[model samples]
Target: MEKNAIVDLVRSKAEGYFERGEFFCSESVVHTINELLGWPYSEDVVRMASGFPIGMGKSGCLCGAVSGGSMALGMAYGRKHGEPMNEKMFPIAKELHDYIKSLYGSTCCRVLVRNYEFASPERKAHCVKITGEVAAWIASKLLDDPEISQKINPNFK
Candidate 1:
């Protein structure tokens, strides 16, 4: 699929997952990205991202979407065993952080969810939008970067 199409698909899927209450903010982002990228569904990835929701177990640290997006990026570009860290991944991660920060003014979930009650309709709606937007943003970045896309999926064209 084309990049824009893939972005749309990912966004739609993320939104669906959120609306269905199938996953939390972070889980939705990571799971949707992996699904869209044709990666096998990973229980481990979902487990790892579970704590990221509600801002690092509701401690109000980094936004769950941001953390999940970072993990997705790492899955795509992180170094393998015995391989040195890939410096290129840093800029991409930074860009993701900057984009989220630009949108919400902070990467903190507490700041992002300020005044919203947990599991309330208002909070769910807000988080649903964040999950979709973050997933789409990561999809766009991955599709636009040929090197990263090819690295992640050799058949990605």
Candidate 2:
């Protein structure tokens, strides 16, 4: 498939997962990215992202989508145990973080959704939108990198 189409598909899937209550923001990104990359990590890898929603288990710190996006970045760029550190990991993670921070002035969920009531549709809509955007951005990044793109399913076409 073309790059934009793949990105849009990923965005739609992530938003659907969140909107359907199948996963929260962080889990949706992790799950969608993992699936997009042909599940290099088991789908169970999504468990690691679960606690990230609601800002570190509801403490309201970092945005869950940002956290999940960072984890998705690590899946592509991170080093495994005892291996030499992967140099690309940190910069890419920071790029996602900065992209989010630039958009909202903060990566805090509480701050980002402060204008909407916690359980209101407005708040859910806001989070769902962020989840889709982050998932799409991660998809673009992965597809643009030759090595990572090789891992993505061409069935997206």
| All candidates: TM-score | 0.88, 0.96
Compared with the true structure, all predictions reach lDDT values of 0.81, 0.91
Report per-prediction Cα RMSD to one decimal.
Answer: 2.6, 1.1
Model 1 scores a TM of 0.88
lDDT of 2 at 84: 93
Q: Write the per-residue lDDT of candidate 2 for residues 1-157, one digit (tens) a residue.
A: 7899999999999999999999999999999998898888998999999999989899899999999999988889888789997888888888898888887788899999899999999999999998998999899998889988999965552
Which candidate has the highest lDDT of all?
A: 2
Candidate 2 local distance difference test against the native: 0.91
Q: How do the residues 48-67 of candidate 1 rate in per-residue lDDT, one tens digit apiece?
A: 88889878888889988889
Task: Flag clash pairs in model 2.
Answer: 1-157
